[model samples]
Target chain A: MRSAFEWVDALPSSIALRESLNAYPTLLTTHVVSMCLFAGLIAFWDMRLVGLTLRKVPVSNIPTRLFPWALTGYGINLITGGLLLYSQPMRYYDNFYFWAKMALMAVAGFNMLWFHYATYKSVQAWDQGREIPMSARLAGVVSLVLWAGVVVTGRMMAYAGLMPEWWNNLNIGA
Target chain B: MTQSFFEWMQGLSFSAWMLEETWASPIIQCMHLLALVAFAGAVLVVDMRLLGRGLIKTSTARLARELDRWMIWSFVALFVTGAPQVLSTALKQYYSPFFWWKMQIIVIGLVFTFTIRRRVAFAEEGTLGHWPKVVGVLSIGIWTSVSVWARLIGLLS
Candidate 1:
C-alpha cells in the first residue's frame, strides 16, 4: 500500500492536478452553485409537504414538477465530484471519513429512490388539492427525519476530517 | 442507531483528518449546505401550516406527515456525508459544547414531534392548537440553531 502511494504520488497527472489550482477549485465552485440550485427547489418541495407555503399548489405537483430541476443539482454535484476524485484518488482510500461520506450519500440516494416508489407511487389518488391521505403524511414525517439525518452526518464529516492517522492506527480495532 | 454509531466512530485514527483536503470534500460541503435549505424549508412549511400560515384548510396531520419525508431525507444526506468529516476531526469537536447542544436540541425537537403526533393521531383537518404550535416553534428554533452551529463547526475547524 505504501509502495502504491509512492507510485500514485509520482504519477504525472496527479502531480499536475495537485500542483494546479484550476482543476479542483473550478469544480468546487460549480459544486457550490449546483448545490444552491438543487437545495432551493428541494426546500420548496419539502415545505409544501409540510404544508407551509404554496398551499394553492397541490402536494403532488410540487415534488413532481419541481423535482426535475432540483434533481439537476444532484447531477451537477456528481459531475463536479467525479472530476475532483479523479484528480486525487488515494487521499480517501484509507481515509475513513471520506468513506463515511460516501456511505451517507449512498443511503440518501437509496432513500430518495425508495421514497419515489413507496410514497409518491400512489400519490395521485389523494393528491386532489386538499384530501391528502394519512399514509402520505406519515411518509412525509419519515422522509423529513431521514433528510435531516443526512445533513447532520454530512457536516460531521467535515468535523471528522480533523483526525490524521486513524485508519492505520486502528486497522486492528475491529 | 445512527447517532450511536456516530459517537462510537469518534475514537478512530487521527489520519481521518484528511477529509478537509479530499477532492470530493467541497462538493459534500455544498451538499451539507443544501441539506439545511431543504430541512429549513420543510420545517418552516410545517410551522407555517401549524400556525395556519399555509394549507389553511388542509389536515394538519396530512401536511405535517407529508413534511416528514423531506426532514428524514435531509438528515440522511447530512449523516452520510457528514460522518467522514466527524471522523476526520473527532478530537476537535468531541468536547465542543455546540456538539452536545445540537444533540440535546435534536432530542427535544424529536420529543415534541412525537407528542404532536400522538395527540393528533386521529386528527382531521383544522388549524393546530397551542401545544402543537409551540412544538412547531421549538422545531424551527432547534433546527435553525443546529444549522447555525453546524456552520460554526466548519469555521472553527
Candidate 2:
C-alpha cells in the first residue's frame, strides 16, 4: 500500500502538478467554482423535493431541468478533484475527513438512486401544489444533509493533522 | 487612516477570539459555504430560465421573484458571517490581492444583478427581445466570477 502511494506520488503528472506553484491554486479555485455550481443546483432540486422551494414549479420537472447543469458541474469537480487527489494521494487516503467525505458522497448517491427508482415514479401524480410523499421528502433531506456534509468534511480536511503521526507518515516509506 | 481602521478591526475582542478559537473559523467558513448554496442555487435556476433551457414551462418573472428571495436572504446571511472572518484577518486581507479582487467582483456583480438582471427578469414576458438572453448569459458570467474569486481568497491567501 505504501509503495502504491509512492508510485502515484512519483508519477510524472503528479510530480508536475505537485511541483508547479500555480497548479494548486488554479485547481483549488476551479474545485470551489464547481462546488458552487454542482451543490447549488442540487440544493434547488432538493429544496423543491423537500417541499420548501419552487412549490409552484412541478416537482417532476425539477430533476429534468437541473440535471444537465448539475452534471456539468459534477464533471468539472471530478476532474479537479482527481487532479488534487493525484497530486497527494497519501494525504487524502490517510485523512479521516476525506474518508468521511467519501462516505457521505456514497450515501448521497444511494439516496439519489432510491429517489429515482422508488419515489420519482409517482412524482407527477403529486407533483405540484400539494404535499410531497414522506419518502421523497426524506430523500431530499438526506441529499441536502449529505452534500452539505461532503462540503463541510472537505473543508475540515485542512485540519487533517488531528490524525496520528504514523497515519499520515505511512506513505513516506520506511 | 486605513491602517488604523484595519488595526482596530483586527484588535477587536471578537476578532481576536475568532483568530484564536480553533472551532470558530471553520464554523464561520461552513456558514459562508451553506449560504452560498442558497444564493448560487437560486441564481442558477433563474439564470437557466433566462437562458431558455431549464424550467421552460415556468414563467420567468415568477421564478425570478421567488428565487431572488432566497438569493437575497442568503447574501445577507453570508455577509453577516463573512464580515467577522474578514475583520479577524483584516491586516492580511488588506494586503492580499485575492481579497481586493473578490471585493471588485462582488461590487460589479451586485451592480449587474441589481440593475440589468433585475430589470430584465422583472420585465413582462415576451416584451423584451434578445435582451433577456443577454442578461441571462451576463448574469451567469458575473456570478461565476464572483463565486470563484470569493472562494479563491481562502485558498490563495
Candidate 3:
C-alpha cells in the first residue's frame, strides 16, 4: 500500500505553479540574497538582546525598525526555498540531512515569534530604553545558536546524500 | 603573473603538504564555515544600527564606531584564513565560477563599506540620521549576497 508520503511524492507539479525554478540562475541568485538578508537582520536583534551596542536604543524601536525589513527577508526566503523544494521534491524528501535542516529552521522561526511576544515585548515596556532583562538575553542566545545551526545544517545537507555504492560521490566537488 | 606567484606558493613544501592531507581539507572547510557566521553575525548588528533601525539610543556614529572595533577583526580573521587557502588552490579556484563571482561581490562590498564609512564617520551629529540607515540597508544587502553565494558554491558545485 502506498503511504500518504508516497502519494505526495508521486504527485506531479502543476503547470501554472511557477514551473519549479525555470530560471535556475535567477532562483539561485534570489535564494542567496534572501539567506544573507536573514543573517543581517537577526544579528541586529540578537546583539541588542545580548546587551551590545543597541543597549542605548529604545527597546520598542528595535521591533518597529527591523521587523519590516526582517519580514521582507523572510518573504524572500520563503519564496526561494519553496521553489527549490518543489523543483526537486524527491531528492530532498528522502534525504535525512534535508529534514534535519528543515527541523532546525522551523524551530528557529517558531522560537523567534514566541520570544517576541513572550519576552521582548515585556522587556521593552518595563525597561523602556535600558538594557534588556535576563529572559531576553537567554532567548537571544538560543535564537542565535538555533539560527546558526540552521545555516550550518543547511550547508552540510548539500554534501550529504545517500546513494548506492556504484553511484557515490555526492560530496565530491567537480 | 598571478598564476606564477600562486604556483610558486603552491610549490612550497608546506603548501603542497597542506593540500595533500585528507583531514586538512575538512578542517579548512569547517573553518571557512565558522568565519562565515562570525563575519555575517557581527556585520549584521552594525548594519542594523547604521540603518537606524533605532537599534541604539546612542548616535549612529557611536554605534558605527563600536561596530568598527569588532568588525575589523572578524573580517581580518576571515580574510587571513581564507586568502592562503585560495592562494594554495588558485589555479583550480580561478577556474571556478563560484570563486570569481564571490570575489567580485567581496571586492565590491568592501569598497562600498569603506566609502560610506569615511563619510559616515565625519558627518555632523544629526546629519547622520538618514545616511547611516542607508549604509545599514546596503551593507545587509551586499553582505547577504556574498554569504549566500558562498553557500550556493557548495550546493551548485
Instruction: Output the number of the lDDT-best candidate.
Output: 2
DockQ of 1: 0.10
**Candidate number that wins on lDDT, 1 or 2:** 2
- Greater TM-score among 2 and 3 belongs to 2
Model 3, global lDDT? 0.65
Candidate 2 A-chain TM-score: 0.90
Query: Could you tell me the TM-score of candidate 1?
Result: 0.47
Q: Write the per-residue lDDT of candidate 1 for residues A24-56, one digit (tens) a residue.
A: 656655654555446555656654566555565
Residue-wise C-alpha lDDT for candidate 3, range B23-136, written one tens digit per residue: 554456555655565566567656665665535565656666666655777688778767767756666665668877888999998898788754774466666557766777
Worst 10 residues of 3 chain B by lDDT: B22-31
lDDT of 2 by residue, B1-157 (tens): 9889989999999999997897899888888888887888899889889888889899998998888889899999989989989999999888778788888878998889999899988888888998889998988888888777776776677
lDDT of 2 by residue, A1-174 (tens): 667887898899999898899888899888888998899999989988888878999887877888888999989998999899899887776777887888998989988898899899987789875788898899889999999999988888888655546656664323
- For each candidate, how many residue pairs have backbone atoms clashing (under 3 Å)? 72, 0, 6
Greater TM-score among 1 and 2 belongs to 2
